[model samples]
Target: MIDGALFVVVLVGALVCAVSAGALYAFSSFVMKGLTALPPAQGIAAMQAINRAAPGPAFMVAFLGGALLSAVIAVFTLVSWPGEGGPLLLVGCALYLFGMLGISAVAHFPRNDALDKVDPEAPASAAYWRDWAREWTRWNHIRTAAALAAATLFVLALVR
Candidate 1:
């Protein structure tokens, strides 16, 4: 039926988005490691440099792309969610959507906005930079988890 076909497309899109999120998560870890390894003074400098570069645009692109894909999956799942395994797929899709949107709106976007105006070469206190990095990493972890959850759900929907 048409519903089944739509479901298939959504599932594939969800899986692709999930994979992309995982790749982004890995990149985040790499950035964290690089930041953590620096001496306090250099770390602050590096953080400022990164912020000034406006890394937020990249996150926004990724977040929006994933969200759009997940929305498609959610819509299709909703349309045909009365059959066998349909409810499960719906729940999974909902979780993924909620999680992705929540993190983007609550954590990532705020940090990105804050980073936009920071001066790269201006002297910053160590505590401030340390706290900021920790916060960023924490949100990154949330995003990664949500992406994984979304992938798992899509895979389940495909199998069932």
Candidate 2:
């Protein structure tokens, strides 16, 4: 019974996280597009402003929410320890969690903390800000990709 419950939770959470991960990946692309459409200096300035603003909190809410849901699944998996693929799904969930944490601890949180020191409305160095934004976005892309991959593996586990 518990195994059944865990399987259900993992399946559902994986689906939700996968969708959200894809959405975030697309959003990054959208931001890039928006930047490209702008004049070079203006684009750099806008990206800088956005970076200083630490807009990731909103996304983190989603990421963390998904993670919490997955935690339930993880607990279930551990308790139940279903068939062969069950372990794989759990591994996927773990990877996803690590990726999310990596983004938060390594990339996003630091950027946000730094942003707290800087003025989003009036940046000190547009060049420095641009560099930071690019780096942050790059990490975000990696995070999102890993999350999606994890979600995919989890879904595959369901099929197996």
Candidate 2, residues 67-93, lDDT tens digits: the string is 887787677667667565767777777
lDDT comparing candidate 2 with the true structure: 0.69
Pairs with backbone N, CA or C atoms under 3 Å apart (clashes), candidate 2: none
Winning candidate number (TM-score): 1
After superposition of all CA atoms, the RMSD between model 2 and the true structure is: 3.8
lDDT per model vs. reference: 0.66, 0.69
Judged by lDDT, which candidate is best?
2
Cα-based lDDT at residue 33, candidate 1? 75
lDDT of 1 by residue, 21-109 (tens): 67658747797778777875676667656656644766555556667766776676566566655665666566566776677678866
* Cα RMSDs, all models: 3.4, 3.8
